[model samples]
Target: MKNFKILNNYSIRSKLIIIYLFCVLIPMIVTNSIVYITIKSNEVREQRITMEHAIERVKYNLSSVLDDCVLVSNHLHNDITLNDFITRRYDNLLDYYERYNYLLQNNVINYYYNSQHVYQVTIYTDNDTISNSSNFRKLTSETRQSEWYRQFYNNNEDMTISVYYDDNRKNYGINNTARTISITRKLDNFDKTHENILKIDVDYNVILNDILNEKMEDNLYVCNKSYILFSNKKSNVGTEEFDTIDSIEEKDVKLNDFFRFKVANEAWNIIITANEVSPLSKIVERKEILFGLAIFNLLLPTIIIILVSHSIGYRVTLLGIYLGKVENEEFSTIEYNDGQDEIGKLIRSYNLMVLRIKELIEVVFKRDAEKQRLELAKKQAELKALQSQVNPHFMFNTLESIRMRSLIKGESETAEIIENLSALLRKTINWGEDYITIEDEMLFVENYLQIQKYRFGEKLTFSFYVMGDCKGIRIPKLSILSFVENACVHGIEEVSHNASINVSIFKYDSRLFIEISDTGSGMEEDQLNLIRDKLRNAEIDMLNNSKSTGVLNTYMRLQMYCNNNMQFEIDSKPKEGTDVTIQIFLDEPGVSNSFVKENQNNNF
Candidate 1:
């Protein structure tokens, strides 16, 4: 309930955004994702099923071809003429040829010669009288050593399927050494005097082509335990030595699914494996349609929601902004001509309230301002009257006459003191200018210090130094002089020994630094702290509560002169000395004379 209340506090725009996200965006994304995943899963399953069916087709084609060779072998095994001819010993080559030619014409193997699947048929016997020929050969010691002969002779089965390389065929100038697949059987159907065997070499290319005719996307391997007999890949069928089943699998790492069946009493395998196909390839085909649907489902609804929400929320938000301005005392009317809704009525009511309050403020504010203006004028007249009491022209003329008389009396030191006093009075009494160059201010300070030097005699010493281009930089009039006056009055008056005051001015890092150090009776820690605190938090109101108004007044004036962009520091040790440092940023305005003058008069 609390969460719902907080949600209700949200603006109409926020609520609409939430609706777009959950109702439109999320459902659309989830629907598309489920569709994509279903399509991918089906594609993978179909690929697997297709590969399995292809393997079955390849196995059937392979079995059919081998069955043909098995049939041919069966006929030869049962043939009494083939059995009798090999068993009979031949007396000579001419007589053997006559018998061979006659048998060849009447042989059952002659029928298989024109068959496309059968390559050759040969009979081997141990009869020493029978010469080696194309169709019949006498088994020698080397023939006994051959792989196929040994397997057949040792096997207990009457018939066996074998795939082996016939290196002896290479001598027939058949330079292509294709591996041979043959069905070999012992011809013991009729008891014969000599041991006879019949072998049928099937056309390897014909079986391979049959497998290829299936046009399976996968590689197909037909293999026995000992060797791979044939493959859809023609190159795999023609090795001088048949490759092991393990070797074929190593080359075709993807060949995993296999079917095992007997071929002529020997176990054979048909392996089917597919090439890799990218899963995304099928998904990409439907992406454009899915994208279009998503735009219709999510984007279209989102755009509608935003437009409707903006129509409602925009005025509400604008009214809220105007309300905020009113909270800040900015009584302004709304410029938008909104509808006659509840919020529009509230705006109209607020505008009426603002107009009434503004009218009341104008009436009261003007009356009070007129009263303050009259009071300020009276204060200014009284201040000008007090300032008129001190006739600077008369004082200057008198000082000039005294200095000329001292010069005639040959009192050079007195004349110099009088001249310094006159210059100090002129600079101090001038109220028209609040700013003076560092050179003029330093000159005024020098004149004041000369008078102090005359008064203190040898007990006081002073030095003023200005460095860099700071001499022409402008500053508030008497900004440094007040602090110098305080240093002399409080720092030197109580000291017994010779005291020296030093003032140095310089500019660095675009800031003007004015430092004054005096070797005199410094204040105690408590007094120094009080003076430092007063300088830190100096304000026009402090002049009423503090006795050290001179230094505090100068500090505040300089602060206002520099737009409050200046720092002041005073370090003093009792019975040791005092140092006052002022750092002023040269970038700040220092020409606002009326600001300081008005505040100063108000304090007075």
Candidate 2:
């Protein structure tokens, strides 16, 4: 009946508003996230297509370079110097080259292919044929060599390609600069001597260089079976030794023989590279624009949604606040702005909480009044209870002896700090009253800091401010002390920079405030969130949870005595620092019984 009465007391409109808010909020988040992902997917697809087109271009260009070499061979075979030089001597080919200059010279292929091998018209008629030039005048049998006889002539092949390096003569080596490929053939109606052999070497350097010219901005490089010719982002060519199966400098690069991915008709492995314009960029840009617009479009509704939800959340927060304040006599009523929304209904429910509070107060008052009448009888019982207790004075005496011994051993600071701790504990734990001076808490804290001071040396700095006669005011136990330990462990432990800690206690609005701030290695929003989550779920039995749990466990114990009259707030940022303020009311619930007897004794 009482629970039904409690439910009936709150306005009906609040429940409907809460239902309406959920209807709007859930769908809005899901739809916006979906739209963002869709836009990103399309961008990725477009980038892939761009990458494929680029690969095709590299293959076509390499094919054209190979084709140019074939054209040069066809033009040379029809010339007379090729035949005349083999039959006679080097002098016999002079007029033939003059006559066939048009056929031999291709301005399009000449600029880079301008080396002697590409333009020189030479013919070797037979195995022993030697030119009558000054360089070949004394050519012996050992000096004579035929590239055509070994590679193309004897095989009766239509054509053959060979790469040759004559180390002894230092002559007629294809891509003499790099030791490369050349095309050769045997001519049938040569009329040049008995040898029907014709040898032609394609200048591979010229072809490779042509590719470098066209893509003036790409890493247009060639990697033979042995090494890679490199061009940097600036198009400067150099050589890079190949040690691995391969490594790619830029993404989507083609390494015909280097890559392990299945290839299509893959001779002449080509590598094509680009800088600012890559497949990834195009894909990302296109998708970003599409989905970026989608996400941008979602912002308006999102803002409205946040404002509405926060309003609802704020009302709930205030309701919890009102219930907490009513637990003490400090606040007896909850007044709020009128509205027909769900929050308005909640405020109405809160208004009826006043009646619940009134009934609780009456029950407690009647109970206490009866207890006062029996207080004389309880005093007799308390005397009996005291009679059975161990003497706290004896424990303090032992601790005092330890303090004196440390002092005698020349540990003056250690002795002084321990002496203070002994007194703080004796007064707080065994005191007859629940309230103690703020000044007394400060003394305990200062003594604790003094012990830490000797350990940290120069790394720690502290400040303390006390107000409202820090004496005779009861408080939640283990409130400020735990945070001090937390500050030292988390804040100062990892800091490389100079560190300082400031602990200030004061009074505002008839409340006691203890703000402990640390300057050390600060934390980012994400780190701070993770720390808070660990702190909030900690129960009193947190020692069993994990060894790392700290301030949160102490907070659970404090909440038992002070309830929500104590407020804990944390503010932190990356590389900045952390501030934890624990605020408590000086008087609340049962002020006399709330404080541990230890703090009260320390007050005097």
Candidate 3:
């Protein structure tokens, strides 16, 4: 359990190596070792059994071949007719021919010719009256000097096996020296004759062919003690005299097995020397192939495991890095090519979560900013109310007294001017309402323009145009009056020539359009664009930092009133005129008197 725990602690790559060693490499080595030992042992044992069977077969065939020759020789020796024919005195060649034809009819040699591998049957005798033909031969000086006859006479037994080369022989019509193996016996069954001998030649090629038929991958020798009587290799069969088995031994032949048997009173040996291949040669020859297979088995799996483990571990590590970044509040998405597997799905889900979180954070931040803006607007409203509370009753009474004094002094135009000034000051000092109908706001605009016209005299000309249906549309207080004040101060006061100011409030397509334009020494493009940018992007914070608080405040309030469904545009040309247009959809969502009322109650 402790070892298992330690193994678990190791990385996946190391664990895979351990698994290969134990599961594949070690087991394979043990299995191959056992298989090699068992196969080698079985191969050696099977070779020995095979060699034994082969040698035994060669011995049996040799014995059978020789036995057939001896059997034929025994028949000739015991035959009364054959004995009488060879021993009888013949008067003429015709009588001998007639008797020889009769003997040929019952010849045992003809019966055993193909069946017993017999080549020929010859009866040799020193009977001078008998003629020599195929079956009967006259023994002469040359016959006595032959190797077959010599070997037989030297054995000095009643019967013997003789193997020698007959140089003056023809086999199958081919004149060549051939090896002859035969059984020679003295025909003494019941005879009173000279030396009658029977010789039955066992076909040497047939015997050699029998040994060759074993189909063994080994060198075989059929030997008579020291002389090699037969060999499976045709070249090894003796030409003139039989070769000795000791010559084979001298050539460093590795003869490891022998089968000895008796045939015709002579011990013959079957010697087997293995071919150039070892019994375990198969294992030796395939050693390199086996080693390569082992390496392929080990290395292939190792590489596969490493690739699989790296693929998994690398993706998991990448996820870990992204997770760390997320923990640090870095809401960045995973910029990776995704797969269809479980881990790839996880990464895609994480990206989606990051996107949703970022959206929610933006919503929360916007809500907080709105709250701060409302609070600041409320404070500024309170400050304006406080500043407006500076002895307003006394100031009004003093203005009334001066206007009545001017009327009593018959300066009627002076009294009207003082009255307009006093009324304008009173309306400007009041902060009782945040939103009023366009009709009420236009009255305020007229008062402010009246005071400006009095200051500019004939140099300024101003007019107000309000559509019939647009008069009752509610808007933020001072939203239009602020722009009119800017026109009077910048346009009418700066120009030496007569400059005209126009204020138009009209409705088209359910939208309220308020346009304030002035014909005066118009502003440069840079100043116009600056002011336009300021008004378009107006915020509560600009009220504190910007010198143009009046215009900025008016734009911000109008935005809040229309719920940002308001558009403000500025069009101007140098030395020509300036135009400011604000378009708002009156019936849009949240663009209603109740929406402004709620804001007013909350702030005031």
Predicted structure with the largest TM-score when compared to the true one: 1
Per-residue lDDT of model 2, residues 1-604, tens digit only: 2222233334445544544555455544654565556555675555445545544655564455445655565655664544443454334455535533543463422332544335232333453334344111232343244443454434445665443443433343333443334555444445634554434444445554545555344454445443453232332121222222166464645333332212111133446555443233333456655575456546654664465555556567878888787666655556665455556676787777777767877898789878898988889999989977977788899889988999889998778878777866775686554333555556667776777777788888888776645455555444566677787788787787768888887667656677889897778898788767765665656668676655766666566666656677788866668998777764565333545453355452
Q: Which stretches of candidate 1 lie over 4 Å from their true place?
A: 1-36, 170-177, 233-237, 247-263, 275-277, 287-290, 293-604
Model 1, 415-484: lDDT tens digits are 9999999988887777668787778888888898899999999999999889846766667788888888
Off by over 4 Å in 3: 1-39, 170-177, 234-242, 250-263, 275-280, 284-604
Clash totals in order: 0, 18, 0
| Candidate 3 local lDDT, 1-604, one digit each (tens) | 2222333234555666766776588757865675566576777677778878887787678768777676666666777888888888889999888888887787644665655467778889888888877777999999999999999999988778887777766343222337777788888888855888888877777777787787867677877765787776664242456787786754535344444334455666667766443434565556865587567666766765665455456667888998899889898888874445556677788889999988877898789889999999999999999978877888999999999999999998778878888887787787677777788888878877777777788888888889876666668887898988887777777778888999898878767799999997788989888887887666777888977677778878888878889888888887677898999875577775664454355341
Record all residue pairs in model 1 with backbone atoms less than 3 Å apart, i.e. clashing: none
Comparing 1 and 3 by TM-score, which wins? 1
Report every candidate's CA lDDT.
Answer: 0.75, 0.56, 0.75
Q: What C-alpha lDDT, on a 0 to 100 scale, does residue 601 get in candidate 1? A: 44
In model 3, residue pairs whose N, Cα or C atoms come closer than 3 Å (at least 3 residues apart or on different chains), thus clashing, are none
Candidate 2 worst ten-residue window by lDDT: 236-245
